[model samples]
Target: MLHVRAVCPAEHTAEVVELLREHPGAAHLVLHRGAAVSPEGDLVEADVAREAADEIVDGLCGLGLDRTGGITLEALDTAVSDAADAAEEAAPGEAADAVVWQELLGRTGEESRVNATFLGFLAIACLLAAVGVLTDSPVTVVGAMVVGPEFGPLAAIAVGLVLHRGDLVRRAGLALLVGFPVAMAVTLAGVLAGSAAGIFDPGTIDGNHDVDFVYQVGPASFVVALLAGAAGMLAMTSAKSAALVGVFISVTTVPAAGYVVVAAVAGRWDRAGFSLLQLVVNLAGIVLAAAIVLIVRWRRQRSAPLLRPLSRG
Candidate 1:
């Protein structure tokens, strides 16, 4: 479905070919050798499917093929030649790559950290959701969901658990701990400002306004969170990143956090507690669901047969 292009030194062509031949999911491998003109001159050009690109890159790196030479892999937009698949089949190699367990663990850990960008987006999302809460507009609430960036850390936590990465667990936990409070505080401040300006009245809390949607968190919300989390994790690991935007908008964390701010400003402690509960329920459901999905994937990967090098015919 995806295409991959790689360039390596000509002298390392044999190793590259052998690596691709062993990868089971990889097909349509094309190799053009002695065409590059770098400072060293004449490298090998390889084109492959996007599905197998990650495995191939990891394999070549493991074989020390990149130490002296160079390897670059990129996704292609168009279909490749069928002849490339035939050549890969005829090649003499196994169908597997060396697993870099430590590197995988490290990458998983890095993905879970709540970096600056995530915090910034969370701030904006919460502020937007605060406006939605004040106005009781479902449309604006949905917009806040679309803009929130909380899914990355949650997915990172799931991957971390599957890989048993302590660092990832810590980082994800820290993000959740810090992110919610900061967002809530900002929303509270916004609510206070709106109230002071007479744009929003604290008395609106009791008015059974059509926007009472903020107070009705239940099992359906949990289900939505679970589905979004699963989709989010898949998007993170797979090549399709656009799907993540949908997942972000499908959950209610931002809206619930914003509701808490509104309630705090209105001096309605009970409503604030209810909104906080909704936030907790949503987050718990998402994290648990993502963890389950990752665990299943890890198990499947472990049970797969290891490929052996092909015997010379």
Candidate 2:
């Protein structure tokens, strides 16, 4: 549910109330008339909770009340009043706002700034993973997993496909293309610096044939990427972010990228190829998974009707 706070002219209170009364999903309508120091000094304020916030806003806009004042909607954790529900039950109009293509596209743009940070984090994560690989410590590797930030671009890509926004598609693609190479280059520089300090020995990386965890890349990795991508998308779109942490751990982009850096420093061409393959596979999986999610969301929106009239006796 969402909490909506609207400030309108005092004269428009009856129209706003009538509109709220018509919405079946809105509850807890509180009207503050002759409010002092409001949006305008003489504006009235209405506080309400509605199941379909987007729809309610749309209806209110349609009634020309927006010209008189502004409305703000915020999501609330608590329940609202029964009278609000009764009002929605009695109202007539659309059930919800039809999915707005431009809005989804705009969201993708907003997501890019977040992706830039994720990319920088990915570089740092690879450094951590390299440390873990050097020490053969699972705990450090897990830390790297938690720190990696590739999920943001992955989620953005998914949202782009769902919304069919070309702008989003372009932005997401740009982030991925620029982010990975920059991260890889930074990791490579870190490896060179570590070697000069004698903290990292390219010799150890070259000699460690037993470290199967760092050397091999295969179809299994690609499959994991695909699954992780889907899970990441679901986590972002749904209200369940807490679960995405596990998905980050399950994928190998950060770990593998770290290994690639180590291999480059050690001159282990074979291992570098393998690690690069892992990165490619993981990225592909994420993109494909996101595309699938968008398709589903688009289809669902297409199938739903816009408005249904209420019976008037």
Candidate 3:
């Protein structure tokens, strides 16, 4: 379920109220006439089912409430009302399986930002992966996978492609293009510094370590990436947060980038080239699979009878 709050212009308040009040997937409708001071309009609130979120939000946007006024939708962790249950039951699909488009947009919009935090996490993940590769620690490599934040932007890019949002695609693409190189550069500097500091000798690495999988590209790499991408996209769209951890650890993007840096520092161009190819393959597979998933879901949702053109009257 979701909690919807909207500030609607005075003239549109009645129609908006009517729209929500008549919807089968909406419950506990509350209207406070002339309540908004900043936007200067009536405030309306309601509890809506997950399956109907896209429809309802689209209706609101069609009426220009998102631009002229304001609309806010928030997920409800626990709705203890029978009306809420009825709303969910009245909706077409199961709540757990619902793909809330607005939710995806909002989540990806924030995630695709190339901010310091995003860069910092990517750098930290790559650095950890470098250490994991040097020490041949599978556990540390997996930890780096979990710490990597690349999935968000990758998913964002897929979402943008499916939704035809060029801005989103551009922003996410920029994040990846800038993020990977910067993270690799940071890892490279760290690896070189560690070698010079006598902490770890790059010349000692023989490329026969268990962590060699990080740079070993094969059909299995693409296959695993595809599976991980599909699962990750499903987890994001269906709000299955617990499934995301599994998805994250299943891909080798960060570890491959880490190995590329370490291999380059060790003067092993062959290993570095292979690791770079692994990274590209993983990225391409994940994005391709994730985009396909979104396209399928978006098409299915668009065909649902519950979504119809909004009427101002």
Q: Candidate 1's residue-wise lDDT over 82-110, tens digit each?
A: 75565445433322322223333444555
TM-score of each: 0.74, 0.73, 0.95
Query: If the candidates were sorted by their lDDT against the true structure, best first, what order would they fall in?
Result: 3, 1, 2
Q: Indicate the worst ten consecutive residues by lDDT in candidate 3.
A: 304-313
Pairs of residues at least 3 apart in sequence or in different chains that clash in candidate 3: none
List the global CA lDDT of all models. Answer: 0.66, 0.65, 0.89
| Off by more than 4 A, model 3 | 304-313
Which of 1 and 2 is the better model by TM-score? 1
Cα deviation in Å at residue 156, candidate 3? Answer: 1.0
Deviation from native of the Cα of residue 255 in model 2, angstroms: 1.9
Write down the lDDT that model 1 would get.
0.66
Tens-digit lDDT track of model 3 for 1-313:
9999999999999889988999999999999988999889999999999988878888887788977788888989999999999999999888877887777887887898899999999999999999998988899999999999999999989988877777888999999999999999999899989999999877665854788788889999999999999999999999998999998899889999999898888899999999999999999999999999988887777664332222211
In TM-score terms, which candidate is top? Answer: 3
Q: Score candidate 2 by TM-score against the native.
A: 0.73
lDDT of 2 by residue, 1-313 (tens): 4566667666666877777665566666667766735456233233343325546666666554455566555545554566655544544433232333323343445665535476778788888888877666667777888898777666667765554545556766787678777877887888788889988786686555444565477877777777887777665544356878988887777788888878877777888889888777887888788668656755665544332221111
